[model samples]
Structure formats: structure tokens, C-alpha cells
Target chain A: MSLSTVAGARLVARKDLRIEQHSRVALAQMLPFGMLVLILFAFALDPSRDVLTRATAGLFWMTVLFTSTLAVQRAFAVEVDDGALDSIRLSGISAASVFLGKVSALVIQLLVLEAVLALGVAILYNTDFGGWAMLVAVTLLSTIGMSAAGATYGVLVSRLRHSSTLLPLLLLPLLAPVLIAATKGSEVALGQEAGQSWSWVALLAVFAISYLVLGVVLYRPLLEET
Target chain B: MTTTFAPKIIGTSSPATRILGVLSIIGLIALVVFGLVISPADFELGETIRILYMHVPTVSVAYLAFIITGVGSVIYLWKRSEFWDLLAASAAEIGVLFFGLTIFNGMMWGKITWGVFWRWEPRLVTTTVLFITYIGYLVVRSIPTDTRTRGTVSAVIGIMAIVNIPITHKAVDWWRGLHQSSTIFATVDPDMRGTQLFSAYLGLTVFLVIFAWLLIHRFRVAWLSERARGIGLDEAIAARRAEGSFS
Candidate 1:
């Protein structure tokens, strides 16, 4: 019998997160890498200029975008190595499930990373957060949008020979709207810019929803290629 | 195996293509005349009105090509046909070229009119995003892979990437609050009389013909390369056999 989408999603997610829990890749590597990036921004733009404080939202999201590429690369690496994806295929689960599973796991991991990054931004960039409602809304939508798009493109490039180098090239341009929306919305949230942040949040919702739909519909074909 | 090793005629030209070429050339001459000498300068835009003749059509054709690419991607996925795949890839290649022209012409328009080559305006950002999306598409297409895999992955991308144009436009619009006077066509030239309208229409028609001509050529080249690869595989095997069993 073909596994139900929900069941398959659960199984795959559990498998991935369980593997992550054992390996500590995200905790040990991604979190610190994200923090180092936060610190490096300080080095790149001297803190005395107070540019980081004024530009906190942009730097924070830009850092997330960079580290998320690494996260996506690592997420796909596990399946592509050692014939694991092939076994998953033979088990009669849907590709959509695998896509959803990977995206969910990436979402959780990235949320954790973003949380730490938010803290880093608070401490290092000296950002004072306000507009709590829009802040939470934009963060949630942006993460989902990033994770869904990343997962879709992630599986597409996973099996390629130069996939490590190729994934960002394929994924980053697709995520431009998210970056713009998230940055602008977060700027409003952080009291750096003044405007209708909800409209930007709406754009993020539209982006996240469309990518989620596209990811579900297109995952089968992408997985077959893999 | 005894075989005819003669090189296959891979010429993409034909009677139809020749007709397209001739029509395109004729249209282009007319477009130039209408754009430069025939059409009067606008009350507001002056000589800068001429750039719109090229700019508007290129942007229109770029969007048209991308829409076609999206449709082709959908059909390719549904039918699993190489023809649709080739059509999608061809349209995308042409779309990228047109978008490049659009961006360049747009920059000229912006600099002359607004005193800057680039701005954070909605159209500019949206255009650049679409351009970059297809650049990624073209880059991924260049990587060696099985035909089906390449087609499948590219089809998936083509389907989703098109959604970005609207999302980007909206995001930038919301972010920037879209000043009405800042735009080119909307505020200016809402109503064109006589020769001005004619020239605008003429430019659009000519560029469309040019786009069709380019699309046909690009599709033929992609199809030809695939055939050439197949023929090359046989030749490589034959040459290996002639080397006396791995000599």
C-alpha cells in the first residue's frame, strides 16, 4: 500500500530530525556559523559607525540568507549520499511527502538558527524591537517561504555532480522577493523604517503560499529527476 | 555494421524561416522610420519619447516569452515531450535576451528622465529579478545530465519562477508607495494621437516578429545539438572499435 502523505511526511521528518539530533550538525555547525557571520558583519562594517544598529534588519536577514544556503546544502547531502534517497523511493512514499518532510525539518532547524540570529542582532547590532505583531508574522512567513523554496530547489540540485555549488545559484534568485519583503517588514518591526509593514507581510504570505503549492505540485517531477 | 556516415543536414533554415526573416527585416525598417523620423516628439518626454519605442516592446516581448515558457513547461510536464521541453528552453533563452535589452533601455530611460541609471523602483527590481531567474535557468541547463532529468528539473523551475514577477512587483510597490509621476508610460502617453500611436504599435509588431525569428532559431539550435550529441555517441563508439579493442 502507498503510504499516506501525512504518514510519509512524519516518517521522513522524524528520520531527518532524528539523524540531526544524533549528529548535532545544525547545533554545532549552523548555529555557530550563523553567529560568526553576525560577528563578521561587525568586522566588515565597524560598529563605531553605528551602521549595524541602523541597518540591523537588513544585516540579520542577509545573514540568514547566507547561512540557510549552507543549511539547505547540508539537508540534501544526507539523502544524496549512500543511496539513501533511492531506498526512500523504493518504499512507495510520495515525493510530495519527502518534499514536505524535508521542508518541515529545515523550517524547525532554520527557526532555531533565526532565533539565535535574532538574539545576536539584538546584542551585536543593538536593535530595539517593536511592532511585535508584524515582527512575528513576517518572521514566520519568511522562514516558511525560504524553507519551502529552498526545499524545492534543494531536491532539484541534490543529485547533480556540482550540486553544492549549484544550489545557491538556483535558489537565491528565486528567493529575492522573500528577502525584500522580510527585510522591509523587519525594518518596520525594528522601528528603523516607517510604513505599512502588513503589506510587506502580505507579499511574504503570497510568496510563501505559492512556493508551498509549487513545491507540492512539482516535487514529484523533481524527485524523479533525483 | 555497414552504415552511411555522411553528416546529416542540420540546417534550420527553410522557406518558412526565410519568410519570417524577410518580414522581420521589413518590419524593423518600418519601426526605425516610425520611431525616429515619422513620429513627433511628445509634449512631456521630448526626444526621450523615442526610447519608449524600443523599451516598451522589449519588455512586452520579454513578458510574452516568459509566459510562453511557463505554458511550455506545464505542457512538457504533463505530456513528457521533448518538443515542449525544447520550446520552453528556447523561449527562456530569447526571454533573457529581450530582458537584457529591456533593462538596458530602461536604464537609459531612467538616467535621461530621472537622472539615475538604477533605482529601487518596482519595475526595475521586478525586471532584474525575472532576468536573474532565467539566468539561473540557463546556467542549470548547461550542466550535463540526462535529457529527462534536465527537462524535468528545468520544467519545475520554469513553472514556479514565473510567479515571482508579480510577487516582486507587489513587494516593491508596497515598499515604495509607487509615486505616479515616477513611472514612464502610465503617467505619460496614456493617450497618443495619430503618428505616435502608430509608431508605438509598429514597434511592438516589429519586435514581436523579431522575437518569433529568434525563438525559431534558438529552438532549432537546441534540437540540433541534441541530435548531434546522439550522432556523436555512435561516432565515438565506432572510433573506439577501430582502435583494435582498447588499443
Candidate 2:
């Protein structure tokens, strides 16, 4: 008997995580690249003034957005390089399982990267911790939303030669809503603004769920084409 | 694949499209005359509001073109027809053209009205995002792939991109309103009367006809090109076969 979709998803996710843990390329390379983006933003803007502190939430989210692209690229690269994708497809796992597995793996990797970048933002930008729980919640929700969209598009473009360049062009515009909602939510969570952050969180949740369902429904056709 | 004859490009244009082409030209002349000379200047915006005739209609048609693209994409995905895919691709090219025009005109209007070339206004930001998204859609089409794969991938992107439009609009509105509450621009309401309304209507009708005309011609061109490419591929394979190459 074939594995259940949920079980297959877990199996795929575990396998991806194991590979990532062994490679460590994402941790060693992408984390510092994200940090470099944050540091460069300070210089490009005004480091001496309080602008970086004021824009910490927006800047931090931008860093995460850029870094998540790397994680997504690496996720598909591994599967494509060794022809593992074809093996996985022929293994009787549902397309939805494969999609969810890739998304989950990307999200975990991004969360780790975000943690490191968050610490960097705290130290460099001097962002005070306010409404810490809300901050974490916003981060988690937006990260899921971003990773879901990213992973879906990543697979969609993986076969193309110019996928690395094309992925961001396709993804960034689609994720504009997520970026806006997350930035606003983080602003409120950081006490920079006075308002309910839950609405933004709700929007992020809706985006995340919508893309996840879309990926599930569409992945079968997408996989067949490959 | 068996080689097929290229379809006649002009055969795609029906009598209705020819009428539309003439009507669109007439309407264009009327719009220019009415907008530049006939419509009275707004009390607040003075002459700058004239840009609205061109700006508003281009954006309206741009939205229409994109909606058509989304519809074509859905139909293509369902029916797996090359005609629908070509239609979608044609409409997207026209949509991108209109989108570019809208942004350019908006920037000009912004400079005259707000004393700046650009701002993070919700509509402007949303249009910019839409522009980038569709441009990416076009770029995806340019990738070297089989026709079916290209059609499938672009159809997926086209549909997904349209779905994001409303979300982007809402998010930008919320983001801008929250951060820039104090910088709101108060101007004449878009509700117009007399010559202003007439010119706006004229512009919209003209642009809509232009879009239809361009779409038909573009679809024909795309079909012919695909046919030519297929013939070329068949010839290449025949030449290789004659050379005693066997797989």
C-alpha cells in the first residue's frame, strides 16, 4: 500500500530537512547574505539617525523576503540535480504531499534564517522588544505565507534555465500583499504604531491558506508536465 | 509533428473588427478635440485634469485586457487549445502597453498636481505591482520550452497573478492610509459633467476598440509564427533523417 498523503508529506519533509542539515549551505551562506542586506540597508539609508530603528520592521521583512528566495532556490535545486523529483513522483506520493513537504521544509529553513536576522536587526538597529508574542506570531504567519507562495512558484519555474532570475520577478509582485500586511503587522507589534495587528495577521493567514490550497490543487497537473 | 500550412493573418479580421478600427480612430480624434479644447478646465486642477481623459481610459482598458487574459487562461487550461493561449498572450501584450501608458500619464499628472513625480499612493503602487507581475508573465512566455509546457505554465501564472490583484490593492490601501494619513490629496471628484464626462466616455470607447483591434491582429500573428516554427522544426528533423541519423 502507498503512504497516506499526510504521512508522505512528513516523510518528504524529513528527507528534505535531513539533506539541508547535512549540506548546511543555507545556514552558512544565506544567513550571512540576509545579514549583509540588513547592514547594507543601514548604510544606504542613514545609519547615524534613528531611521533604521524606525524602519526596522519593514527592513527586517525585506531581508527575510530576499533570503527566502535563496532557500526556495536551494530546495528545488537539490531535487532537480539528482533527479530526485522524478523518483519522488514515481514513489506513489500525491502531488499535494510533495508540495506541502517542500513548503514545510522551506518554512523551517526560513524561520531559522529569520531568527538569526532578527537578532541582527535587534543588535544593529536597536529595535526594542514590544509585544513579543505578537511579533513572533506575525513572523510565523507571514513566513508561512511567503514560503508557500515561494515554493509553489519555485517548482513552477524550476525547469526553466533562467529560473533564478525569473522566480523573483514572478514571486515578488505576487507577494506584495504579504509584504505590506507583514510590514504593517510588525510595525504594530513593535509598538511603532497604535492599532490592532490581528487584522494583518488574519490577512496573512488568508493568503497563506489560499496559496496552500492553490498549490495542492495545481501541483498534480504541474508534476505531470515534468 | 506533421507540418501545417500557416493561416492567413488578415483572415482573422472580421467585418466587425474593421468597423471597430474605423470607429476607434474617429473616437480617438473626438477625444483629443474634446479633451484639449472642448472640456472646460477644472477649477482646482486647471489644465492638468485633462490628463485624466488619457490616463483613466488606459487604466480601464488595461484592467479589461488583464481580465480577458485571465479568462483566456482559464479557457485554455480547460480546453487545451492553442487559440485560447494565443489570445491570452496577445491580450497580455496589449495590457502591458496600456499599463505602461497609465503609469507614464499618472506620473505626469502627479508631477503637476502633487509637485512630485511619484508617491506611494495606493493606486500607483498597485498598478506598479500589476505591471511587474504581467511583465514577468510575458518573460515566462519567452523561455525556451515546448508549446504545451509554455501554455500550461503561463496559464497558471496568468490566473494566479489576477487573483493577487484585489489583495494587492487592499494591502496597499491599508498600508498607505496607515502610514500617510496626513498627506491625502483632495482634488476634484472623478464624477464629471458636461464636456468632461463626454470626453472621458469617448476616450474609454476609443481605447476599448483599439484593444480589440490589437488583440485580433496579435492573435493572428502569434498563430502564423507558431505555424512557421513548426514547419521549420519539421524541416530540420527531415534533414537529419536524410543524413541517416537514427535514435
Candidate 3:
């Protein structure tokens, strides 16, 4: 909550975003890959309009969940080279700042992915969007939880030689709660089901807050580790 | 001098452990007898309740094991001790084993009682996810790396994985609640009388003892392997040096 912490977080987030901007991995690669996954789902499922329409919410977040792994890997992938993380550590920013920073970068990239996937869902599935405000809230809350949880696991496996494979195995199960809340919340937001979307959003908020807090507290121990 | 003929201890064992092993064996037999024969069928659940006798114990012990793993991981992070690292790793291994058994027994019980091997119930899903998370912890431990690095990573996972358990459970619970009544799994009703109660309690005690026995042995194995790895590397280095000098 210190201004310094916020400033440090912004610094790291900007750095990651800058790297991302130059590389265009999120925009060029992940966005296309995410859309392709949506396209693939249409093939896997009954490409018929009704089924795809019902499944849009789940599939969108599921795509987000899958690609968040890539984003996280890239987020920490930047740090794995030439002891960049070590330099960052020696730079005197709090570990929480570094963690928040990474999560922030992840959230931005996933939001972009989600935005495109949302359009893909609308177009390919012939779906209509309703509850715009609720949908945006769900997207923000769910993306925060997903990114925080992803970043936490991301750094834990960052240095392993087999990290690319190991990261998803370790991460996906932990993301179960976030996926459930997000998918369900999106379902309600899309009017595929009745009742309160906010309730599910509140559930997502719980997940978001829990992982954010977890990331902050646990990041220091892992950040200091080799 | 004549060499004395002494039997080699080929495994992690000693006099105390032997006695502990024997006690668990006896307790297991008692449980089997009570659970299979002496215990009467519940009016509601009937003979199927016997599976509960096994199912409850394994899952409970698994929970206990992971709790130890969590605690061990925390202390290791704090104290940087090898004992806690080995203990955490050992407990997680046993926890995975017992959780596997729990699932197997649970599936069998479900097949018999509900005519289905699996259901998308909250408890079932939560248990599966918990199992996988610890499996991840074990995989992290197994990754080839420096001892401190491996321990540090595993410890972080051990801490984080346990924190996710309750959250996973709650999420699944509400996830289920959204659609239907959350009957997920049944608990042993307190109205049980006589041998049924005795068998249930016996099953729990016996399983706890078995878990302790497995944990102690597993810890010894992990500790030995680490020591052996260190010594093996040194000997290899020494041998290569001698070969170089001779050449």
C-alpha cells in the first residue's frame, strides 16, 4: 500500500508491457492462437449454433485459462535469462511489487485475448452478448484471479529446465476455482442461465482476492530463492 | 576372527519400527473382522457402509499427511533444515498414496451404493484436484536440481497447494450448489450402534498408525537417497581424478 510499492509495481509492469509491446507475442501470437482455439472448438463440438452459443462463456474463459499459461511463462520467461530476476531482486523493490507487476502485465494481455475471443465467440458461434457491465466485471475479476494464480505458479517453476511442460501441470489444477467462478459468472452474464451474475462475480472476487493475497505473501520466499 | 552371522537390514527398519509394523498388522486384522463380519448392516446404508469404514480412514489420513506436509514445508522455509524438507516430501508421497486409495475405495463404494463409479459432485472433484496438486509437488521435488533449489521450490508449492485446498472445496461446493442440492457425500451418522461404531473407530485408528509407519519409512528413504547422491558425486569425482593422475 506504500506509494513506493505502487511505483515499483508500475515500473515492473511497464517494463514487462514494453517487452511485450516490442515482441508482440500477446498481440501477434497468443491472440491468434486463442482465436484458433475458438475455431477448433467449433470443429470439436457440434458447430451447430445452439450448442456453440451455450458453450461460448465456458470456452472463452477456458481459452483464457490455457493462454494465461503462455502469458505467465513469457512474463517470467523474461526474468529467467542472464539472472534478470537476480538483478531485479538486487534492485531493492519489494517482492510483492514484482509479483503485482507480473500479475498486472498478465491481466492486460489476457484482457486483450479475452476481448478478441469474445468477438470470435460472437461471430463464429452466432451468439449475442447481453449484460455488458456484468460481463466486463466478470472479465476483470476473473482475469485478476487467473493472472495472480498463474504468476505465483509461474515463478515457482520458472527456473526448472523442464519448466515449459511442468508449469501447466502444476498450474491448471490450482486454477480450478478461478475457472469455475469465471465460467459460471460468464454464463450468468451471457444470459445462458438465469439468476444473479453478481453472485458468481462475487465468487470470482473471492478467488481474485485470495490469490492476490497469496501471491503477495508467498512471492518473497520464492523470489529470494534461486 | 570368525565373523558373526548377522542378518542385514535391507530396508529402513529397526526394532521399534518392527513392533509398530506388527501393531498395525494386528489392528488391520481386527478392523477387517469387525468391518466384514461383526459389524451389522445399517438400516439405511446396509452392507455398503463397510466401504465407508475404509474410505473415511484413507481420506482422513491423507488429509493428516498433507497437513504435515504443509507444516513441514513452512518450518523448512523458516529454518532451512533438511529434516523438514525430507519430511515434507515424504509426507506428500504418502499423502498421494493414501489419497489414491481413498479414490479407489470411494469409486468402489459409489459403484456398489449408487450404481455409478463417479459423479461430478463437489467432494469428488475437490479430492481429485487436491490429489493432482500434491502430485505436482512431488514432480517438482523430483526435478533434477541443486538440493537447496529443489527444496525451496517444493516448499513453495507445498505451502501454496495446501492453501488452495479449502478454496477449491468451497468453489466446487458453490459450483455444485448453483445447479442442484449439495448432497456430495454422506458422513457416518452418529446413530450407529454397537459393532458398526466400533469398526469405524478402529478403522480410523488403524489407518492413522499405518500412515505413521509409511511416513517414517518414506522419510528414511528420502534422507538416505539424498545422502547417497552427495557421496556418489564425490566418489565419481575422486575416481576421475585418480584416473587422470594415472594417465
Candidate 4:
């Protein structure tokens, strides 16, 4: 809430984004992986049965979920390299600022991935983006939820040697509600069902807000341990 | 500070816990006999309903275990104590065990009733998520780290994961409605009567007592292992000093 906190968060976020721009790991490697996951899902599920069209929302969200892990891992891996995280901790910025900064960086990368995957789903699955606004709303809210949860778990496991493997196991179950809501909301947005998409959006918003708050409060303890 | 090599008894069960353990064994035997032999078959389910005795109790105990773990986690985080950390770890282990059993029994029950071993029913889905979350908690605890750090990390995970239970249940239910005919498997209904009610209560009580017994023993084991690790570290440091002297 403090001006300094906001300034600190912006500072951290810019640093992360600048590092990512230089390395381009997410853009070069993770983006293609997300696209490939979409293509693979098409192959795994029969197109002749119209299953791809019907399952497009679920598949697209699955791709995003899988790729977000990579983004999160990269986000924290950057900090671990050269003891950058220790320097950040010692720099006197609040832990909440650092958490917000990491969540923001991860969310930006995930939003890009989501955009690419949306195009892939549209082209390959031929999904009719009927409720386009609802779709975008759902995507943004769910991405925030995922990124917040992902960033928290990423930090929780950052100090462990086997964090890469442990991160998904720790995160995915916690995100099950997000997946369910986003997938269902996507279905409604695609006009596949007459059910309420807004309810799902509400759930996503609640999930996102809770994690954002939790990240701020818990980040201090997590930082202390590291 | 003077360092001693003696193996200190950091944790041990009291007479109360020993008595509870014995009582739980007796109660378990009685419940099994009642559920399997003494209780009459359900008018609807026949012999398959007997699985309820085990299934219901396992899930009940699993929930209890997780609640205890959550409480232990909160206390650990607030107080920063090793005892609470060990308690949380032990409860999570038992919780995971019972959660697995809950799924296994649910699968068997589903196979008989629904002609499939698995269904995305709300309770089943939520339990599956709970199982995986706690398994992750256990995995986090397994990573080699200082006790304080490990406890802090796992405590944070424990608190966060438990908060998801209700949300998961609601979301899964909204995504797909509960199975209509699973009334028996649903929480106890008011229409239930007589021996069936008795058996269910007996099973729940027996399992709870068993959980308590297991928790006490598991906590003691964790404490002993922690002490042993500290002693090992001390000895290694002493050996390094002696080697330096020889050089």
C-alpha cells in the first residue's frame, strides 16, 4: 500500500522483465511448447468425432496451465542464479513488494502464452469465439489466479534442490478450482452450454484475490526461510 | 556449551496413549466383526454395503487428520516449535494414508454399484485432490533441509492446501452435480435407523482412536530421528576438529 512498496514492486517487475527479454527462454522455448501441447491434444483426441471443437476450451487452458509452470520456474530460477534473490532480500524492500513483482512478471509472460494458444485453438480446433468478452475476462482472471498461486508455490520450493519437480505437484492441485472454473467458463463463452459463465468468473476472481492476499502475507515467512 | 553424545529421549508415549492404543485395537476388532457379521444386509445394497463400514470411517478419520495437521501447522508457524512441526508431519502422513484408503474403498464401491471403478463424483474428485496435495506436502518434508526451514515451508503449504478443501468441493459440485443415488454414501441422513447407525458410529469412533494412537507413535519416531540427526552432525564436526589437530 505504501508508495515505496509500489515503487519496489515496479522496480522488481521491470528487472525481471528486462532479464527475460534478454534471455528470451520463455518466448523461444516455452511458447513453442505451449503450441505443441495444443497440437498434441488435437492428435490425442479424435477430430472426426468433433471432440476437438467440444474440448477446445479445456485443451487450451491445459496448455496454459502446463506452460505457466515453466514461466514460474524461470521466474524463480533467475533469482537463484548469481544469488540475485539474496541481494533482493537484503535490499530492504518489503517481501510483499517482491511477491507482487514476481507475480506480475509471471502473469505478463502467461498472458502472452495465452494469447498465442488462443490463436492456435481458434485455428486448429475451429472454436467459435461467441462470448469473446467473457472469454477474455475468464482468461485474465484465471491467469491471475494461476500466476499468483504459481508464484507462491515457486517461492515455497525455491530453496529446495528438487524444486522443479516439486513445484507442479505443489501447485496443480491448489489450482484445480481455477482449472474447473476456467474450463467451464470457456465452455460457456464458446456457446457450447447455456450455463452461467459469470459464476465461474466470480469464482476465478475470488481465487485470484485470495492468492494475491496470501502471497503478500506469506511471502515474508517464505523469504525468511530462504 | 558442552556437547554430550548421549541419546536423549525427546519423545515418548505416556500411559494414557498406551491405554488408548489398546482400547482402539479392541474397538476395531469389535467394529469389524459387527460390520462384517453381526449387521444385517442393506435392503438395497446387500453385501456391497459392508464396504461402507471401512470407507466411511477412513474418510472421516482422513478429514480429522487433515484438520489436526492444519491446527498443527498454524501453531507451528505462530510459535516456531519443533513439536508442532513433527505433529503436523505425522498427521499429514496418517491423513495421506487414510485418504488413499478412502479412494481405494470408493473405487471398489463404485465398481460394484456404478459398473466402473472411478467416477468424477464431487466427493471422489475432492478427495483425490486432497490426497495429491498432502502427498506433495509429504514430498516437501522429505527434502533434506534444516528443521526450521522445512517446518516453515511445510507449515505454509499445510495451511494453504487445507483452505482448498471447501472451495474444491464447491467447484466440483458446480462443475458436475453429485451422484443422486449415492444417498447411503452421503453424510448420515436422518432416515437411517437402528443397527446401521450404531455400526457407522462405532466405525468412526474406532478409526479416530486408531488415528490418535498412530499420531503419538509417529511423532515420537520423528523426534528420535531428528535427535539422531543432530547427534550425527555434532560427531562429524568433532571429527573434523580432531583431524585438524592431527594435521
Candidate number achieving the greatest lDDT relative to the actual structure: 4
**Which pairs clash in model 3?**
none
Q: Candidate 1 docking category?
A: medium
What are the models' TM-scores? 0.95, 0.93, 0.93, 0.95
Q: Which scores higher on TM-score, 3 or 4?
A: 4
On DockQ, the stronger of 1 and 4 is 4
Model 4 per-residue lDDT tens digits across residues B1-247: 6687565555567898889889998998999888888888887877877888788889988988898899999899889989999999999999999999999999999898889998877788889998999999999999999888999999989888877887787788888853566533576544446777788788888988999898889989998888889888998998999899999
Candidate 2: tens digits of C-alpha lDDT, residues B18-134: 898898888888888999999999776688878888887888889898998999988988899999999999999999999999889888888877889898777788899999999
Error of 3 at B216 (Å): 0.9
Instruction: Kindly report which residue stretches of model 1 are placed more than 4 angstroms away from their true locations once superposed.
Output: B1-5, B185-188, B238-247
Question: Candidate 1's residue-wise lDDT over A1-226, tens digit each?
Answer: 9989989988998998999999999999989998998899899998673898887888889889988998888888898888798899889989889988988898888998999899988888877888899989998999999999999888888877788888888788888888888999998887888887788898999899999999989988887776
Q: DockQ winner between 2 and 3, please give it.
A: 2
Which segments of candidate 2 are over 4 A away from where they belong? B1-12, B178-190, B242-247
Please give the lDDT score at residue A147 for candidate 4.
90
**CA shift at A207, candidate 3, in angstroms?**
2.2
- Give candidate 4's error at residue B105 in angstroms: 0.9
DockQ, prediction 1: 0.77
lDDT per residue for candidate 3 within A21-92, as digits (tens), equals 999989998888898898899899986888988888888888888888889988888899767899888888
True contacts kept of each: 0.80, 0.67, 0.78, 0.83
TM-score of chain B of each: 0.93, 0.87, 0.92, 0.91
Output the worst ten-in-a-row residue range by lDDT, candidate 2 chain B. B180-189
